[model samples]
Target chain A: MSADRPLEKLRVLVADDSPAMRGIVRAVLSGFGCDRVFEAENGLQALAVTESGGIDLVICDWKMAPCDGIELVRALRDPARSRDPFLPVIMLTAYSETARVREARDAGATEFLAKPFTAETLYQRIAAVINRPRPFVRADGFNGPDRRRLERDHSGAERRQARQS
Target chain B: MSQAKPYEIINPPNKLKAKTGSIPAVNPEAIKRAEEALEQVKSEFRNWLAEEVRKLERAHADIHANGLGGKHGEALFVVAHDLRGLGSTYEFPIVTRLAKSMCKLIETAEKRAAAPRALVDAHVGAIRAALIQNIRSDTDMVGRELVEELERQVIARVGAEG
Candidate 1:
């Protein structure tokens, strides 16, 4: 076997309406040593899981009702909430079109994997997203109180500017 | 093309049977809809994980520096609760697995005279990696137009009378 990937035992969310598709994804992920797998039938359920918390990776179908992948990405990237910072999104779908690919990017997807994907493709994409960590700062501010104060002051100034406008 | 016959009939599969069918080509629209819904879940999950990681880190900091009251522990608790729910809903065993681990870590730490910050930090790192992988999975999946069409239909039907 190859050098064991550090991501072994990683948690993954598999959201698809089809039990077969979900099973396939789970099996594929487990083949790479992903022992923890999650499944959701719809976007709303997926959102609940996401919001509920602790997901390491999400492998979602491109199509679902009420909320689709694109809309989900848009919601997650909402500037107002800073919903998920640097969350990598890998879209799984059967729609093979250049325009659609472009749109997925616009929808805030970190990576795109077309349907009928091989195990290699799945592992590779998962590897890429998992390897890169998002940049984050403690709510108290990384630098010190001075830095926190500075940020607060900046926000205050912005608020005043908005009022003036 | 064969001519229509009296014996031939179009028995469209019922909703449950249609959903149960393994072959995706039978209903492109349904597949697309499923894909889009899954996508949305994946995206939201990514963000949620990111935020949880940050919160976990903050909790660690609070324990190390000022100790667990005020905003840090509260945030950690909130994120942990969310993870527990998400894990069960999405069918991701690891999310719940880690969430339970972290939740216990926090709850136990709170009861202790001096919390174990180091162990908590290690768990936080593990959870963070898991969250990142989740996001990557979301982006890697494909099939866009079908999902888009589903989105369009949902929009068109949201206000329609039954």
Candidate 2:
């Protein structure tokens, strides 16, 4: 597990009306070594960013004046418009009410971060979401000293399994 | 009237006070840019607050039409709490003060076991008046200062009355 994985180019969108809150988020994200961070003041602006594409993740506050984080999530997760419907969204909220949290989760938020969270919490969450491996599987049963031996053994086994399936 | 408290009184466990300073952390040029950005936000925030004040007026009018206590009082408390929190955050001291007073009135109504239509209506009217005053203001700084003075007077009067 090298620290320098190829996640440097990932773009994250942060939506919060408070300049103070936005600054804290940007500082924390930068501390995590993420280079591409975009910000929006409200859900409407966040929606525009999503429409423009290339955003890997969205972290939004739930209580903007109008068209809040839930509405934002609905718009971004809309199958009709999005290139990827399961775009992981993390919602930030000051209110820690259980019912509201459940409502946000039901509205398609992948994660919820309560206000006044730490930098460590923020980084841990981003790392967990972004580091998920794509589906390309390989298995080797034999002990091989070199690459050629491992490839020969795995390829032979994979072909046999593919034929059986 | 019901025996319900209006304010949440979040003690923050460790009492995490907000940091204040005479100068900003960013460089002079960066501070200038931040201020410009903040000015834009301030304008937009003022409009948003004005819109909320109108909505608050409408909500109070509804309270008068249907009376307070029961579900209406509960809803009123929820909105008032929201106004207090956001108003304080954005430096709208008057709205926050007015909202706090309304919260107390609502709390009183709840504690009384039965809020009469007339008394409840009076409280609702006061809330509406404060909201109207908020929208007529020209700038946030002025609105905030005036509101603080108004709040002091209001709290004093409420104290004297009690």
Candidate 3:
């Protein structure tokens, strides 16, 4: 997690249908010191790559042929199908609407970066996923990282306070 | 600040080395490299942009050749979506705005039919103009006026049809 080497020794996956987008993402990943970057043209391919294992993070586009990012996330979070359900995922898309953001979040995305994003924003999201790892949550209807940014106990005290004692 | 936690995946085909406990610092050199790579992509965008514009033109021609409502209209939607996604990234913010407006028009049109010919023409024409003129800034007066006029026409057309 060292800021100086955020992506050191990590394997990342970039999934998108556009060759241009894939190249750009790969370049960005390389700049971040992630040398072992894998590329997949669609969600299905991404799933296959993830299943093969060794990937530390996934950066996926929202739209693609055969399968999409949301579908990919759903499958990845499914304990029956996922190789590593705890793997961090960042969803990228041109659509920045509230509905799109909510859809990705509900689908278990670790981070959301809107399209036309700068390297700084991309790096910030990567930092967030690595430095602020959220605990996974498994409920009857949902199986993914916890959605809440802040954690509180039943009595409304911060969960960290309980750990402090 | 809490100690940086070492996150590990329980199972992996190949295990990775444990990372240190500090947030990765933003490397200026990396940013520069990324920017340079993006610039290379941008340089190639002119060809891509030209191709997309040609597709738009052909689609428009097809609509004229085979009447309205057909595969051509769908093609316009696809092209507009592409432009909307790529324009700003390729340093053509105005094109993005115009294409997004065009998408709204094509999307809101009744049925899967081609949008009103005049509106479609206006949107296509404006996009071509923006690209040819190399209007990169969203606030450029001419580009802003062109977008506003196209938007106005689209709204009027949609309203009349509704």
Best by TM-score: 3
* Candidates ranked by TM-score: 3, 2, 1
Q: Report how far off residue A85 is in candidate 2 (Å).
A: 1.8
Candidate 2: which docking quality band?
A: incorrect
Give TM-scores for every candidate, taking all chains together and pairing residue i with residue i: 0.40, 0.44, 0.78
The lDDT values for all models are 0.51, 0.54, 0.74
Query: What total of clashing residue pairs does each candidate reach?
Result: 52, 5, 8
Which docking band does candidate 3 fall into?
incorrect
Q: Residue-wise lDDT of candidate 3 within B1-162, one digit each (tens)?
A: 554333222222212224534455455766766667666666777777677678778877886787556556666666676677777777787887788778778853363374667777888888888878888766889888888888777667565232
Residue A147 of model 1 has an lDDT of 18
Give the per-residue lDDT of model 2 (tens digit) for B50-142. Answer: 555566657666666765656665655556645654454344555555565555445555342453444435444544554565543325565
Chain B of candidate 1 vs. true chain B, TM: 0.47
Better of 2 and 3 by DockQ: 3
Model 2, residue B86: what's the lDDT? 48
For each candidate, what's the DockQ?
0.01, 0.03, 0.23
The digit string of per-residue lDDT tens for model 1 on A1-165 reads 122323344567777654555765765565554567888876777777777666666777766656777776666555443344334567876544566676776665666787655555665666555443222222211210111211334543221111111
Badly placed stretches (over 4 Å) of model 3 are A1-5, A150-165, B1-21, B25-29, B54-75, B107-117, B152-162
B79: Cα error in model 3, Å: 3.4
Tell me each candidate's RMSD, in Å, in order.
23.9, 17.2, 7.2
Per-residue lDDT tens digits for candidate 1, residues B63-150, read 6686666656655654554454345334444555455455544543343224355545655565566566652221223212322333
